[model samples]
Target: MEKQNISVGLDIGTTKIVAMIGRKNEYGKVEILGVGKSKSLGVHRGVVNNITQTIQSIQQAVQEAEVTASEKIEDVTVGIAGQHIRSLQHSDYITRANSELVIDEDDIDQLINQVHKLVMLPGEEIIHVLPQEFKVDGQAEIKEPIGMYGGRLEANFHVVVGQVSSIRNIGRCVKSSGLELEGITLEPLASANAVLSQEEKEAGVALIDIGGGTTDLAVFKDGIIRHTAVIPFGGNVITEDIKEGCSIIEKQAELLKIKFGSAWPGENKDNEIVSIPGLRGRDPKEITLKNLSKIIHARVVEIIEQVYVEIKNYGHEEQKKKLIGGIVLTGGGSQLKHLKQLVEYITGMDTRIGYPNEHLAGDSDDDIASPLYATAVGLVMDGLKRQDRKAREAQEELQLEEESYDDTESVEEEQVLESEPKERKSFLDKLTERVKDFLDNAE
Candidate 1:
């Protein structure tokens, strides 16, 4: 099969590594072909800690996905997020030599390239430089600048930055696993793509992707990304709190959290108790469900408040920047019971759990449509989109060549009008043409 028709999304998270293979169906929906997941052992807080272990995990996931889909995996689009990720706002302008010339895509590309040259903290590099609004000449707040006449072009940028070393580590791992790295996308943005619709982005919205070791925040307004942040706390922290508070093992705590954990402590009754078997032959321990919820509630609230602070920093409190679409939560941590209610109560905004099914085919598996696979789904979409863009670009190049050829053909036609272009013109033919043209003009 042609490689262009297939796309693979590799999600390397702190809790698990997922490999998803898919293709775009005729209806523009993504048809998931196969998915493979494995426990992540060498990653912490979304960053690679052990190269060998991470590579092995990636290979295992990819191999499983390959077997299921009956296709070889050669390249993949990957998601990246960690505490080291950060974003900032910046403004820049470029002066054009001629105001009479209308602004074009090239001009915008030039301005973006200029912003890319901005100095970063020693080890930090820019990941994405998204333009917010544009100003042509002195006119401001223009969303589309093309075809507008302007001497000076200026715009505000939302620049995402991350540690270069951490980025390199991920690249090395993918390469060492014998796979080509197709692209690296921010996890929050990927999750947003899978869950948030175009209408939501246009009306403004905030996406919170709660992974195993980190929580990612992405805010969109006026159909443009305005702000982004990464918090170090995630599901793992909540599990740690549960284990410590209940004096139980980590595995049991995780199972309990999945089975009975609630973000709202009020939902649990005081008499409800969960018994945990002790180590070796020791007596089992009894813990009240209410107490268990309290631990989760505290950690969940802290994480939500931190994300809220980021929203506030983006000026969401202002009428113009208010997120009418509110918040969409996804990723592995979003599955907690009553978590949506807790978020809505704390932030006072409408909240919904984001499922990756938004762009998937109607018959996609229920398990694959869950919020846990949102990042992987989005990455696959990204890969397919890139493929379309490349094909379109190639077509444009082909058309340009055809147009140029037509221009030359038109020249030959004009020459034919003066004489016979089908026949080679010798010295005698040129002299006869000159004599005939001179005789005709003289008459």
Candidate 2:
């Protein structure tokens, strides 16, 4: 009997922990299997400060998912992002030592491993070694170089690294919850995989995943990743501004941001006022709508400007790509009112909010399929790809093992026959042959 494949994505964010389970159908489309989420505790600024509380939160989320899906989960692909994330670019070249002159998969893998060995910060470890393009001798931007004659093989790559301690802590917490860690994918990479189009990547573009506590950005040019960065502040900061400005509690601030926040202040009606109930026995207060928008706009603008600075630091490399598709803003924070216009005004580039519905089938739950699930949904797609790769490798290994076993069995039989002595044909010989046949059948 054959077993069906199931993939689950567990996202640990600053404000919450989400677990999404999905499976691929016969037609190669992802179907929602289950979902679970819980408000995170003992987590501050996207880093886990207390492991025990984090583990409890994770268990709660996973249990809810299991109940909803009527299935038990043991492993998941996790998403991670924070200010501790960083990206660096480097190139490696190798000339074949012998006269084979043709490059193969091994050569490419060796060169990439060499790039991964590059020195990084003391506490950081490389997460991904993304190949940009392969160059043979002087020719550049080759997507595939296998079977091509090339004495010199070179590859341009983007090396993404993160704080080792931070990643290890997350792994420990997941392990404590009795879940196996598949891999840790950077949040921006997961979001980009969920929303960005191949045409946009080739034409050059920037993807911003704005979550509760951090805004992640990834730049793509010539169909390869050029830069990735994590800004430490995000939508939670806007909520905090509302709390401080209105003298309201944190819960009230979050509710206000969701219910009435705007990315641009000028878009709000000047005369509009939101009535707030009095605290305890105090008199009720009426807060101006424009004022709330003002506070939200100020914080969002700062985040967008930081993205612009990252683009600028990349220098003429930005000019070459031209970013015809401009920016694709995703994640939970991208849903703010007038955010597209705000980003365009600040970066001087076109902007649009990214939704992960492109790969989904007809009439799914609109709430779960929105930009907020970019990382979660992308993790499901990633699980599918990884499953296929592993299946293929397993099939090849099984075939090799079977062949070796057959050869060894045949050698043993030959040795036994060569060492045996021949006997005259008789009733005993016939009986022995029949007994051997019966034993073979029974076995």
Candidate 3:
């Protein structure tokens, strides 16, 4: 029996590292095989700060996933994000020597490669070169330029850049954990793939992934990504605020926020309070739910406002750039109570929590389908897609080779006929003669 293709997604996040293993079922939905998570101690704000701890966390998560799935894991598609990640738009063009030649994939690849050669600030490297739109010989907005006759080809690209040192640290961790880095994808892009629908993207939408250390925003219009931004603040900052505001331990603060925190202070009553047990026989401390909400609300608002400013910068007020699909929020931070309402109110845009269940099998674990796993799920989806593409390309190459061999065989047969002029036996005649000779020899 042949083994099914499986893909692993490793999300090295700020507060936690997650490893997910999955494969597409016959019905075209992701069937999760296993999931593993561990508290992150080495990463902060999406960048790996402590290599040793990050490697340990990765190994732990990968081991758990391997145990649950009953398979050996070797490679992973990792998600990368941080304050060091930034994107810029640039227009570039290539002049062709032959004016009458039709544009081909090679031509497009050359153009993209040219963009990769562009110089950047020291220590910064381009991570993604996403082509927005193409122009052929001064003709504008050509989505597919192949087979079009043009002397000059041009395109606008959204290039994502990140610090080299930060990227290398992640690679080192993955290598030290004994796993190959199959690919690296932007976290927000992965989240969007897991949650956003085609119709939403085509109609213009914004995907906000509020992870532990970063709030990533991706804006899409007319099915093309228009903008991407990573805000340094995330759920961790909110927890920090709660810890300071309430004078509680970090662990206790995290528990309190998950259990009682709300982004909308108005939703909580002033009289509602939760008591935290004191350490070492000290008196228990009281925390009002209303006050907790206020603390959360302040940080959440700041994060939202920073993200909203990016949306505005995208010229959302302009009719062409308006995001009709509004905003879809994902990631663990999005699980907070009343966050959707708060975002809607603040941005004046329709909002909803993004769950990864859209592409999951019906029987997938409920926990894996939550918004928190969107990035991991999306990474697996991306890996599967890449596997399929490679399979298709391999098949095409095989077919081409077979066709070439057949042509060569036909030419050989013709040459033989021309040289000897002997009548060749039909396939059936040859087989019958061989069988008769064998029988006669046996008798």
Q: Which is superior by lDDT, 1 or 2?
A: 1
For residues 289-335, what per-residue lDDT tens digits would candidate 3 score against the true structure?
99999999999999999999999988899997899999999999999
State the lDDT of candidate 2 residue by residue for 290-353, as single tens digits.
9999999888989998888887665524466577888999988999989999898888788989
RMSD of each: 13.9, 13.1, 12.9
Candidate 2, residue 311: the lDDT equals: 75
For candidate 1, write residues 163-198 as lDDT tens digits.
867866777787778887776678788889999999
Pairs in steric clash, model 1 = none
Q: Estimate each model's TM-score.
A: 0.91, 0.87, 0.90
Tell me, by TM-score, which candidate is best.
1
Comparing 1 with 2 on TM-score, the higher-scoring candidate is 1
Backbone-clash count (model 2): 0
- State residue 315's C-alpha deviation in candidate 1, in Å: 0.4
When sorted by TM-score, best at the front, the candidate numbers are 1, 3, 2
Ten contiguous residues minimizing lDDT sum, candidate 2: 422-431
Compared with the true structure, the alpha-carbon lDDT of candidate 1 equals: 0.87
Error of 1 at 37 (Å): 0.5
Top of the candidates by lDDT? 1
